[model samples]
Structures are given as structure tokens and as C-alpha cells.
Target: MTQQERRRGRDETEEERADRMWGELIQEVRVAQTGVQILFGFLLTVVFQQKYASLSQADQAIYIVTVVLGACTTGALIGPVSLHRLVSGRRVKPQAVRLASRMTFVGLLLLLVTMGSSLLLILRVATNNGYVPYLVTAVILWYLVCWYGLPLWARRKHSSDG
Candidate 1:
């Protein structure tokens, strides 16, 4: 292997590494952006529905909060693209990638909240069962496990293996 490959697992310079990471980050952001945007669109229509007026005050409050969370999630997920556009050719890609990654992470967390709140509101409206909160909590835990816990566990395990 070449010296650069031996040092970094690829025969690429810092610029190349930054380029690859930026591409990967954009692909990841696209997936998240699609989901959040769709969800936000649906949320926007909820308030206009005739059924929405029949919802309890507390449920309406939950709906409002969920919509706001969805909006914030959408902004954060889309932030990286705007960041890249504004910073292109500025020779600060590495720093930009780092910031974009942070934005994506925050976006994901907000997405988790948005989904959880949406689920809670839906369940509360669909059924009068006392088990709604518990069910929503369980689903939130599942999202946590799938979206974060498992990846973190695997990262910790495999990083040590290397």
C-alpha cells in the first residue's frame, strides 16, 4: 500500500477525504429531508381538517407542538445543503462537513421528537384507551434503539476491534 493509504486507509489527500465525506453527508441528508418534509406537509394539513376542531384542547396543543417540531426538523435537515451552497469554493469544506454533520444529528433528534409527538397525538385521537401514553413511549424507545442505540453499540464494539 502507498504511504497515504497506510496512514488513512485510502490513497487520498485531505481534500479528497472532505469531498467523500461531503457527498456521503448529502446523501444521508437527502433521506432525512424527504421524510421530514413529507411528514411536515401532512402535519400542515392536519390543522385545516374539520376533525381537527373536534380535538380536545390538550390534543390540539400536542398537535401544534408536533407541527412546530416537524418544521424545525425540516430546517435542520435542509441546513447542510444551504451551508454547502453558501460556502462552496471557500476552502473550508472540512469545517463545513463537521458543522453539517452536527446539523444532521440535531435534525435527527428533532425528528425523533416530531415522530413521537405525532404518534402521541394520533393515538390519543384514535382511541380513548389509557394505554396510549405507554404505547407511544414504547414506540419512542424502539425508535431510539433503531436510530441510535444499536449504531452506537456497534460503533463502540467494532472500533475497539480495529
Candidate 2:
């Protein structure tokens, strides 16, 4: 096999590979975007709720942080579409795909934090229990294992086989 075939691990050219990667990335981003948007929308309304005024100062701070994280996550997930539109047909799909992938990963991390914080606030308010932090920590750990650990392990295990 030629060097190029070995490098790409496929018969397609760079442009074709970029196209495939871009499509897959966009699909993944679509799912994340929808979720973030919905979460952000809900967050935006929380401030106007009647019970919001009764929340403890600490809970208020947590809510603020969570909302900010959600906003940031929304921006990171949506950034690729803006990036693609601005750079379309510029022969930069490969680079764009790489950057977008990174942004998505960061967005996922932000989403994880936002969800954890949101959960903590809700549980603290609902149950008024001292164990809220521990529960949130456990849930975040589960998220980390599912979202990152398994993927990294599979990547390592499978890539070496090739």
C-alpha cells in the first residue's frame, strides 16, 4: 500500500474524509445543541419564578453559575455552525472539523458541570439535606465514566488493534 493510503486508512482523498467527518460532527452537535437550548431555556425562566426569591444566597450563586455554564455550553456547541458558515468552501474543512470537535468536547464538559450544579441546587432546595453534594459528586462521576472513560478506553483498545 502507498503511504497516503496507510496514512488515511481509507481510499478516499482528504476532502472526502473531511466531508465525512464534518457530517458526523454536525450530527453529534445537533443533539447537543437541542439539549443545551432546552436546558438554557428552562434556566432562563427560573429567575422569574416566584420561589426563586426564597432560595438561599448559596443556592442563588449556584444557579447563577449553572446558568452561565449553560450559556457557555450553548455557545461552544453552536460555534461550529458559525465557523462552518463563515469558512465554507475555503478548503479548510479538515481544520474546521478538528476545531469543532474540540469545541464540542469542551461543550460536553461544560454540560456535565451545568447539569451537576443544577441537580445540586434542585436537591438542596427540595430535600434540604446535607448529602446533596455527595450525591451530585457521584452523579458527576458516572457522567465522566460514561461520557469520557468508556470512549477513551475503546479508542485505546481498538486503535491499537488496527
Q: Which stretches of candidate 2 lie over 4 Å from their true place?
A: 1-8
For model 1, how does the per-residue alpha-carbon lDDT over 1-162 read when each residue is reduced to its tens digit?
Answer: 655544457667888989999999999999989899889999999999999999999999999999999989998999999999999999999999999999999999999999999999999999968999999999999999999999999989865652
lDDT tens per residue, model 2, 80-142:
999999999899999999999999999999999899988998999999999999999999999
Against the correct fold, how does model 1 do in TM-score?
A: 0.94
> In order, what lDDT does every prediction score?
0.93, 0.92
RMSD to the true structure for each prediction, in A, is 2.3, 2.6
Q: How many clashing residue pairs, candidate 1?
A: 0
lDDT for model 2:
0.92
Error of 2 at 149 (Å): 0.5
